[model samples]
Target: MTSDTREPAAPTLQPRNTPARVSFWSAASGIGLIVAVVVTPMFWLPYGSHYTFALLMLGAVAVPAGHLGRRRGKRPDARDRGLALFGIVTGWLLILVSLLVFVVFTGTLAALGLLFGTLD
Candidate 1:
């Protein structure tokens, strides 16, 4: 039997050249959702309703932004896909809830007016 003279080489770890980056549109979408939530209470303030609607419309931008963000996140070096998805969901929820509230308020007002014969 021949004696082994050479030692086996140790395993080596490869270093990453760059860190993954968070998608910008994803961050923007998340920020937009936060702003929308914060502005929701303005509906009760005088002349604030218009601003609230405008902000909500602005928040709707997140939907498209989130979509773009999600696509970006699919890349190997991009991140924050979950944040993008959250933005998309919250954006739709805010719009739907606002519409529901508006419809309910108008319906209730009409019912009250009709009951009191004030609608004519």
Candidate 2:
């Protein structure tokens, strides 16, 4: 039997998987770290602006991560979800705690100055 008109089978391409994990969550962590580092230096500006910028960057990372995390071949485990939640919560907590510490330190310094006659 001679097959002269049959088309060749196309090669199947495997989809990438690791990027789904690294791009979103990893990038988010980086952005969160940057925000934490920059907050103190730029604290004089409005807090809302800083928070909004951070949140926007987080959402940008999340969009790709969300899609990558839900692939047909692999399902996200409880541990992954837990880790993500923990990271987010920890970031906010760090910010809150740092702000509190700054407030307390400044307040104490101001009070001490007043008491000692430095700011009379």
* Top lDDT hit: 1
**Residue by residue across 60-79, what tens digits does model 2's lDDT show?**
55545544444422543322
Ten residues in sequence with the least summed lDDT for candidate 1? 15-24
Which has the greatest TM-score?
A: 1
Model 1 TM-score on a 0 to 1 scale = 0.57
Q: Candidate 2 has what TM-score?
A: 0.37
Query: In candidate 2, how many Å is residue 115 off?
Result: 0.4
| Residue 100, candidate 1: C-alpha displacement in angstroms | 0.8
